[model samples]
Target: MELTPPEFTDYDTRLGAYAVIVRDDHVLLALWDEPEVPILMWSLPGGGVELDETPAEGAVREVREETGYDVELTGLLGVETFVMAPEKRFARVGDRPQKNVQVVYEATVTGGELTHEVGGSTSEARWIPLAEVPALERIGLIRKFIG
Candidate 1:
């Protein structure tokens, strides 16, 4: 589907990365605030796949960076495209449209201690009971991944 740019800018495209980590009946999630967005949100621990890195490599790196945990990517979950409006665009260093194409993956937590880092993209990272997840506020895609 065709989507309009979030705003007029030099960069018109954006890409995203995501991971779905499930263990037993629980799933790990990261909660954070997007400065440009009005609400706090919870999602999988992941970020953008860097230019020279493969998605799987990026997934592992991002999970470690955001959650301080190591992960083994098992397989792909799916992909979703989001169109950001001008007001929703959170500019990092340059002016660009705030749209993103997210790649989601299924992964297993291999190792790491649960610890919270200050001034990070994620405020917290913890395991939530799989059943309890539905009741908690989270990205809709997370529920779909669990199903």
Candidate 2:
């Protein structure tokens, strides 16, 4: 039997906000354990920014949801973007290419304790040391911005 790869014909853009929160040389990250996708990744604590809310607000909300931390953004860490093929997406369906526009910022944890998310894209959250991050499996964004 002969087979061919599916042709990518659709395109979409997603706006996400992320925070780089460092404390005692460790970075706060979320474990993305979506069942549909086979790859497990550790990424910054953040997610899609809703239409009505600003990116900053989304960052705070996502951080709280994924990492159980209340954070205050300290400064902008510049914008980053990438085009992901269908098979590589974490949240979006695997049908077409997705352009991810990410707004990253520096933040500080103000309240809440370290806790894992229950029923979300991420299953666990942790504060991984900077020196140990390289050994763990991470998403592309982590390499670009963090380490």
Candidate 3:
């Protein structure tokens, strides 16, 4: 038998991550402030998956940590991939080339009050109507999820 490398090969393709969150016509967004980049940008309630956690578990944990709201995963919404440049500054890392594979899920608010958790990336959390999402400065993937 002949040996060959996989047809598709890339660092991002090999080790991609996912995040799942919910949108109820209006989405709860976290306003982030970064010194190097634009301030007061909205983002979804989820984040990257940890090594020992499933995508769903990471989603729930991220949402709870960022927005202070517990959520129940209902179904998968979609998967999205994006190429992030290294030179570009991110909230977590000042500058890094990061490729993201986000697996979004439909979720429902299960428990907990809507309050910002301390020591989180987000400064504030608010439920913004989907109609108003376009006007707000947000990530492209988040907009897609809301849509």
Candidate 4:
């Protein structure tokens, strides 16, 4: 799930931070290619919040790792959550349902250049035109960034 956010947590619950970087009518995205995870989709640059990192720090770090951008989080858009049943989750660790809590932030690129992450879950990164979003195959979280 990391290319998509953290190294996945073994706990029954997971918390992730994501960033929405829209610049000059283009939005930065990462192609999530984690093999073990079932879903493969174009997702916002973000990942799981580490134990030591705040949500804002986690979002900034994930953005850099997945999209090659140094983003300064401006404000929070909102938090999204989902509960995956035991059957849907790969394996149960502690609870009957796996709870996913995601914090998405609005950000501005301050530094760094576009680069495809190597040896990570995210295979590629790109800035896609906002007008073309509806036609592309992407994750649901993207809807918050694009029109």
Whose lDDT is greatest here? 2
Each candidate's lDDT (Cα)? 0.77, 0.91, 0.71, 0.85
**What are the candidates' C-alpha RMSDs?**
5.9, 8.4, 4.4, 7.6
Report the poorest 10 consecutive residues by lDDT, candidate 4: 1-10
When summed lDDT is taken over every stretch of 10 residues in candidate 3, the lowest stretch is: 9-18
Residue 64 alpha-carbon offset, candidate 4, angstroms: 0.9
Displacement of the residue 146 alpha carbon in candidate 2, Å: 1.6
Cα TM-score per model: 0.81, 0.85, 0.76, 0.84
Between prediction 1 and prediction 4, which has the larger lDDT? 4
Query: What tens digits encode model 4's per-residue C-alpha lDDT throughout 51-112?
Result: 99999999999999887889899999999998887777754454567789999999999999
User: Roughly what TM-score does model 2 have, to 2 decimal places?
Assistant: 0.85
Candidate 2 or 3, higher lDDT?
2
Q: What C-alpha lDDT does candidate 4 achieve relative to the native structure?
A: 0.85
Q: In candidate 3, what are the lDDT values of residues 101-145, reduced to their tens digit?
A: 787777788899889857666778888887898899887667687
Model 4 misplacement above 4 A: 1-11, 37-39, 90-95
The segments of candidate 1 whose C-alpha lies over 4 angstroms from its true place after superposition are 1-11, 92-96
